[model samples]
Target: MSTRIEVVAGRRRWTVEQKLAILRDAFGPEGSVGDACKRHAIGSGSIYTWRRQAMSGELGGARPAPLPSFAEVELSAPVPGLPTAGSHIEIELPSGVKLTVDSGVDADALARVVAVLTR
Candidate 1:
């Protein structure tokens, strides 16, 4: 003789952002869907569902943008010693070489600014 058991669970819907966030965290370095589910107290099936939804564009219209390539940026310059927008300033190093940089700027802008300042 054998006994049969039945289980019933309700389906809980999550927002698209919420689902994507979970999927991103779930697949982090050294992490898997199973591990993520275990760590976050979610079901493995939920992760699979989210993955499928993301692939099919069923969740939302949102998608990650492709990263820009180096060729996309231009590197022309006024040279490093020049100034712009008051945000950047020029400084002469101990070696008597001038450098220009913004108070807080990104690498691309910093490089351009430095080129202008050094020129």
Candidate 2:
């Protein structure tokens, strides 16, 4: 006999949208019932119940907006004396901190600085 194990987070209540998402993932492409159960920390029983409910029209389901799997990015070698002072990037943090950096700023270094600030 397998005992169901659940991974609980800070929030216990799951919204209808979340439940539908779990159901979709449980049976969508790359569907593996056991793997889905383990990944979501939910039980196979619950998945089946949701499936039945959906099929019987007991549950109202909506097709979520499809998300793009990947985006095209262009990377080019940096040019000298480029990205003049006038070209800048600005980001506002939740705590009202305004961060401004030049376009030529190193992405990895800027990411590290942002990570430290967010923490």
Candidate 3:
């Protein structure tokens, strides 16, 4: 004689938004797909499918594209009050002109612009 076990299925179906939310939380800085699967009792394959859909633009509400490289940005004059190449406490432009620039400005581009301005 053998005994049989019955399984009860979940009543709710997850929507796209819900799946995205779960995926985002699951893949956040402190989270991982494996951890999420283990915690939520889900399959690893499902997480991968969601990731593929997200990457292929099938999912909405995704993060925007990254900034273009320095090589891609057009070179321009430095803004007033922007830091230029120099030693501590001194704004040293190749031409000795002080200018202000936004933080995270490409140093290489700045150097090239300074050289042109000095010449």
Candidate 4:
């Protein structure tokens, strides 16, 4: 029988700056925790630990902001003969959120903006 051996790497040491950058990327706009973990070659446990440290002011910086969630928005084209690019429609949700959308705006883009604002 033949035996095979594998070489293991030593533990990686990350500086405070590196950790903070990773934390920011994980929680910043358009950031994904999974993606950040993969890019930094770390696990969720480390990310969570660093996040907790940051929140507790142990990481030497302010806590990372939470990622915004998304909601759907529906829009309709502006009525013709308004003498402008498009008409504006204002909506006020029961949650006290206000949205002013141009009827000529793209539905998907408007949806994304509304989603971010609502979050």
Question: CA lDDT, every prediction?
Answer: 0.66, 0.71, 0.66, 0.76
Question: lDDT tens string, model 4, 1-119?
Answer: 99999988998999999998999899999888999999999998999998878765667755534444445554387556543556687768544888887856766777677566544
lDDT tens digits, residue span 1-119, model 2: 99999986795565667777888888888777898889888889888987877754556655433322323445487567556555988878665789999876776777777666654
Off by over 4 Å in 4: 1-5, 61-119
True-vs-predicted CA distance for residue 80, candidate 2, Å: 86
Report how far residue 37 has shifted in candidate 2, in Å.
0.8
Return the TM-score for each candidate structure. 0.38, 0.39, 0.41, 0.45
- When 2 and 3 are scored with TM-score, the better candidate is 3
Top model number, lDDT: 4
lDDT (C-alpha) at residue 56 in model 1: 51
Worst 10 residues of 1 by lDDT: 64-73
**Candidate 1 positional error at 50, Å:** 0.9
Q: Which parts of model 1 have CA positions greater than 4 angstroms off? A: 1-11, 61-119
The numbered model that scores best in TM-score is 4
Q: Which runs of model 2 end up more than 4 angstroms from their true locations? A: 1-12, 61-119
